[model samples]
Target: MKAAGILTLIGCLVTGAESKIYTRCKLAKIFSRAGLDNYWGFSLGNWICMAYYESGYNTTAQRVLDDGSIDYGIFQINSFTWCRHGKLQENNHCHVACSALITDDLTDAIICARKIVKETQGMNYWQGWKKHCEGRDLSDWKKGCEVS
Candidate 1:
């Protein structure tokens, strides 16, 4: 019985490790379109973390909150506002797509984040994003983040 339990644990670990890296190149290209290459490394990390917290990285994730409203996709974008910005699936342009816009559009999410940080904290406010991405190679995001 103990051996069976141990094997089950190993199986779970293996499966978890096998999880695919969902690094979407098109999304990164979109960021490049917005001229956010310099910040894409840290920005992508923050976007990943935020999406994980919001929807466990499920691009199709949806849920009904206690407020009797439905939240859609990876970033849990509430339906009404989501419709205002991006398409709903078919193009895979659900909440995840909208999130990509944070880096792609540049003005909306990036500007908003900076404002919030500057208002509550100060300039150089994105230091936290930089800190979180420390030691993680930025080369992976270079397609979108590298200026030169």
Candidate 2:
């Protein structure tokens, strides 16, 4: 293998180390501090539940959709219309690179998520919420987290 290939391999390893799988309770605290609680009539449970269904709490999660776009981070933010993958940033409503969504630091991810939800006018933008979280008693998501 060439030096570039080796460097790429090392980069992957480092990136993997940079990721994290946060506990539910911890996530509740984080989300609360980040102002996700009832931000748009959606409780903290909604946020926590969506994060679980989207990426199982993993920070480095990435999913490639059928349309050649990808979903990134714990929120599974879509690259097609939300974030940019390469140099093309025209359609990136989140104003962030797709890679920013995968980082353990969720500042950008949270901000972008707000934009996505606001633009769509609701939490219906996330299939996870519609499938597993919506119309359900999501109180357990923040149970004992003391985020309230």
Candidate 1 stretches greater than 4 Å from native: 1-42, 84-148
Q: Which pairs clash (backbone N, Cα, C closer than 3 Å) in model 2?
A: none
Model 2 scores what on Cα lDDT? 0.88
Q: Return the TM-score for candidate 1, rounded to 2 decimals.
A: 0.34
Q: Report how far off residue 29 is in candidate 2 (Å).
A: 0.6
Clashes of each: 1, 0
**Residue-wise C-alpha lDDT for candidate 1, range 9-50, written one tens digit per residue:** 785463333322234454354445655444433355444444
lDDT of 2 by residue, 83-106 (tens): 888875448988898889898899
Q: Model 1, residue 26: displacement in angstroms?
A: 9.5
